[model samples]
Structures are given as C-alpha cells and as structure tokens.
Target: MKNRSLRIFLKIALSTMLLTCIRPAPAPLPVILNSPVGETITAADITFSWQAQQPAAGYIIQVASDSNFRKIVVEETVSTASANLHLKTDGRYWWRVRARNESNIWGFWSEAAFFILQRFRVVGALKTQGYPHDLAILGNRLFIADGQAGLAIYDISIPEQPRLQGKYLDSLNVAWGVKARDSLVFLAYGYKELVIINAVRPESLKITGVLEYPQPGYGYALALRDSWVYIAAGAQFIAVDISQPAYPNLRFQYYYPRNCRGIAIENAYACVACEQLGIAVWKLDTFPPRQTETFDTDGNARGVDCRDGFITVADGRNGVIFLQQDQAGHLTELAALELNGYASAVTIEDTLVFVACGSGGVAVVNCADRANPFLIATITSPYAYKVGAIPGTDYFFVLDRDLGIVTVKKEF
Candidate 1:
C-alpha cells in the first residue's frame, strides 16, 4: 500500500507542473479617454470618453494644470462611458482617465494634449513669381515687388485671403524693390532706373516720376525712413529725398568697392550690406557720406536690419551675426549662429527675428537675449526665398520659389 501511494503522488505532481507552464498571462487594461489638441479650443468643457480591455469595476477621472497632476483641479470616480467636464479657465489643461479591475488594480494614464485659447483674427499673406524680393504694406493694401513681373498690388481688406488688385507692368526688366507712402509708390526697376507711380487709385496706377541712371545694373534693395529713400545698386548707394512724392530729388551717391545687396534705415542712420565690403554704416544727415563704422564679417553679407541698439546681418557663409552698438557708436559682436544654408534676409519685430534662408527655409529666432539667441522654429519649403511677419499675429508669410506662398502658425 505504501509503494502504490508513492507512485500516485509523483504522477499528480508531474501533471500540476505541466498545467502551470501552459497557462497564458492576463491582458493589460485599455485606455478610456484621449485628450484633444488644437489652437482654438482652450477649455475642456466637452465629454471625455474611453474604452477598456476587460469589465472594469469603475473609472477615475483626474484634471490638472500640469501634465504630472501635481496640482489637481478635479478628481471624480464614475462608472459611465462618458463624463462632462466644465472648465472655467482659459489656458492649458491636462486630463487623463484610469480604469480599476474587480481586484482594485489601476491601469496607466492616457496621453496628454495641449490647447491654446485666444480671440481669433484673420491674417493676410502675399506671394509672387519671378523672385519676390521685397514687400511693403500701406493702409489696408499690400505691394509686392517682383524681379521680372514689375509691381503687383493686392487688397488685404480681408486678411485671410488677399485679392489681386492689379499689376503695373510698364518696366520689363525687373521690379527689384518697392516702397509706398501716402499715395505714391516708388519702384526700383533693375536697369530701368527708379519708376514712381500714383497708387492712390486701386483701379488705376499711373507713372508719375522716373529717375534714370547712366549705366544701371539691377537695383537690388531699398529702404525708406522719413523723407529719405536709399537704393542699392551694383557698387553704389543712392540717397533720394522723397519729401516731394511726385518727384524724388537725388541727395548723394556713396560708392563701395564691393557690390551692395541689401539696405535698411533706422532713425538717423542707414545700414548697408556690401557683398565683399562687409557691412557699412552711414549717417543720413551727411551728404556724399563717410562710413561711421564698418565691421569685418568674414562672409558674404546679403541682408541687414537695425533696431534699438542692435544690428543684425545675414551672412551667406557665416549665417546670421548680431552686433551691439554702444552710445559712443562702438561695435561689438554679440552672437554668430551657423545656419546650414545661406541667410538671405533678416527682419526683427520686438524680440523675434525672422531669417530667410535660400534652401534651408525660413528660421524664426528669439532675440530676447542679445548675447545668446535661440532658434524657436523653422518653416521649410522646396525653395524659400523671402519671409514676412505680421506685427501682432502668430502668422508668418513665406515666399517659396516653387511652392508659392506658405503660411505658418504656432500650434501651441
């Protein structure tokens, strides 16, 4: 009897071991609710829903100002498939849901989402072909200067969509730069010299003034501040006083050995970027001009702009360079960022700087700290040529050589 009992006990033990090895593990609980992500939705005043792997005893809903839920706003336990959440705030909010089994083990939280709340407003965008070099907005209309298309006008009364008003195609060479003040429009035609027209009437724009150059080499860029208008030629900077809109009087022409590509005016000073001459600064009051200060940038300078006490230069080789000028007019290099592609143009508003890169696309940088600038974002296209930003909006307009116009908005 003892031998038989020992043999039966061994067989039972072997059978128990085989059963344990073949059994499968239990499945994980499913995520019930998913958060929404958008720019127009600020609060969570909608229904939150989810799913489950097995039958759940109940679900726990938690809402917080942070993703970690360190500061909890709401904690509720419910058994239904949906819960109504009425948020009273107008900022970013985080929420998640958890399901509990009959054994009381809780599952993991769902993914987090963000939403921005604000008064929505429409923004305008302008683009063109044949190299859109410059843009100027006056009143409610936008003027674009196309390299080979002459002057193109658009009525931006409706910011979201701009309607083409007309195109003044008198100049066949190229419209390099444009400036509008009062009712007059000044255009720099490549070899056609400076052509002025009356832009007061949208239905009809007539040529009112023309300044011919003896030997014109494409007028590349221009800037207008107060009554003075500065134009960049091959190797010369021409200053014209536009106190009289109908007729622009030539003040003086300053010559540089290297070709000038971009020009900008700030208060009583004008900043010019010479391809090989580096950067030259001149006083608007002085006739025939002498350089107040010249910085030796070891790159081909393409665009320049000045604001406050800071000067920004777009160098094709070295990227974008930021320089600070003291009250005594002494210059010091603050920052130099090496962008992969060529930095073609630089424009600043408040603390934000927009750089147009030829192939790398348009880069937005935060210039809050002069010594250390941070690139916030980049808007890329097949061939991004120019970029412009609206003063009070998060919208940025980029002119792409092949993609046409691309409008970018900050989703956060």
Candidate 2:
C-alpha cells in the first residue's frame, strides 16, 4: 500500500509542474491617461501619453472631433505608450487609447480625454517714429531701437495698453538693436558703435557710456551674456567689455566676410548670421574669440538663435533653417521651413519660434520636434522686421517696420 501511494503522489507532482509551465500569462491592464486631459494646448503638435501596459504588443489610439468618436480624425497603431501628431486645424479634440495583446486581441478602450488647440492673437499695437528695427523686453518695460528716432521706452506692465515712458534721440546715428538689463540699456548705435544708457529713471533716460567700434565697422545687432556684449556689425563681429558700466571697452574683433545682420550667444559660443556667407560660429572662451565653423544657407541668413544644442536661422527667402550641434560643436543642417515672405529675424520662446517675415508678417513656428518644424500661424503686419519675446512668457513684440510695436498674447 505504501509503494502504491508514493507512485501516485510522484505522478500528481509531475502533472502539476507541467500544468504550471504551460499556463497562459494574464492579459495587460487597461490603458490609463497621462496628459492632455481637458487642457488647452497652444503648440502645433499635440502629444498623447498613457500609462504603459505590460504584456502589450502595441496600442491603438483614436482622435475625433466628438466624444463619441463618430468623426475620427486619427486612428493609428503605435508600438509605444505615447504619440505626437500635428493637427492642421485648431479646435476641440477627443482621444482614447487601447492596448493590443500579443495574440492580437484588443483590450478595452480607456475613458476619452478632451483638449483645445488655439493659437495666439494680436492684443494691441503702437506706432513709433523712424523705422522700428529691433526690440528688447526688460521686466515690465519695453525698449525699442527706432532707426533714426533713437531708443524708445514703454511701460508694458499692462500688455494690451503700452504707454510711452521715455525717448532718446541722436541726430548723428541710428539705433539698430537694443538690449537691456537691470538699470541700463545697451544700444547698437549704427555707425556710432555701442552706446550704454542709464535707465534707472526711464522717464529721463540718458547716455552713460559709449564705445566706438574700431573704424570701418558699424553695429547692427547685439547679444549680451554676463559682462560681455557681442555685436554683429557691418564688416566685423565685435566684442565689448561692460564689466564697468560707465566705461565700456572694445575687447575683440573677428573679421567677417559679409554683413553681420544678427548675433546670438549660447553658453561658450557666439553664432552670427553673416548675410551672404550664411552662419558663422565663434568660440567665446579664447583670448580672442575664434571662428570655429561656418554653414551656408539657401537664402540670405539674416537672423540666428541658439539653444539646447540647436541653431535656428531666419533665411531671407528660405523661411527658417534648423541645425543640430554635435558634442564637438559641429553643426549639421536638419531641415528648412519655407515661408511666404522674406525672413529677416527670429526669436525663440521655449519651443516656439517667432519670425519676422518681411511682407508675410510674423510667422510663428513650432519647434518641439527640432528635426521637423511646422507653422503655427502668421499674424498679418505691413512689414515685420524683427521679433522679441518677454523672457519666459508667451508675450512677444513684433517690430513692424510700418506699425512700430505689435503685442501678441498666447491664450492658454
């Protein structure tokens, strides 16, 4: 009787082990929402993300104009938990996701989430004397470089209604570019070189110091980093020391082949938009800044801005050109966005790019995907020459050659 019981128990144990080895795994859990749940999205690309479901081979996402998914706009299967898409029109959108098991069986769809897509709008505009070339925003104040009218200051504490606070007019030279920090304002004083103004009292602004570019060069655009100011001039890229505000000094100069229209400083390097020569990169940490690299664009490379290892150029007839910087600081062209007008200048606020399109007005571009930039909208202006942003906010001012300062606000 004992031998028979032992044999039966061994058989039962073997059968249990086989059953466990052949048993099927449990199905993946239902998809859960992660973002864009009843929120207002202002960008060109909308991202749909969800909690990952284990044992899922893929996922099917559906986007529609209604909660019922009757009028579907997007229905695709992706191998990941997130999907990024660009919608052509701005309106309300509802989306949901469902997982697909390894056996190709679809799971239950998650509860639908909704979002709104809206672009920016022009809130207000103010006219200025002479040509409005460049602008800068410091705190609640807006400084404009008005060609022959010199520098104009306005209070933008209230964006919709800008009030003029002060003005500085020089009969000898024109103000081409302007940048401000603290209680001082830096002006690219045309053929007169760099002029520093004491804006401690905005209502009665006065010149504090002036540094003339070594003969043959005229300041057009300027970029400020720390105590150094890099200026894109007529025939040379000039650098100035502003450590002592009242006594500005010219530091270094790099011979540029063509007219330098715009300059942007990023970390330890300075990139200049050299009219016909395209874009030139200079290393700023050296005794005398050295030109490290150069890239040619399809059209006139008028303006440039560098951030997060990427460079954006406003190519006159080509619209916008995007470039990627490698670890060694070498640049490679990624893509080009063709626009309707001549792109003279560009400014970046986070992932959005605002371009001053000569006759096409101001073109807003979404650069969330650096490799592929898309147009968000184009605000109509008689002649948009340059663009400037309010630091971290969506509030930006377009320097319209004919309209002066145009304030734009992004509604969330």
Choose the strongest candidate by TM-score.
2
TM-score of 1: 0.70
Whole-model alpha-carbon lDDT for candidate 1: 0.73
Please provide, for model 1 over 33-137, each residue's C-alpha lDDT reduced to its tens digit, 9 standing for 90 to 100: 543554356233656666654667778888787878898877888886567776543445677777776666777766655444432222334456566767777
Task: Return the lDDT, model 2, position 278.
Answer: 93
TM-scores of the models, in the order given: 0.70, 0.73
Give the alpha-carbon lDDT of every model: 0.73, 0.87
Residue 392's lDDT within candidate 1 is 61
Task: Tell how far residue 354 is off in model 1, in angstroms.
Answer: 0.7
Q: What is the C-alpha RMSD of each candidate to the true structure, in Å?
A: 9.2, 10.4
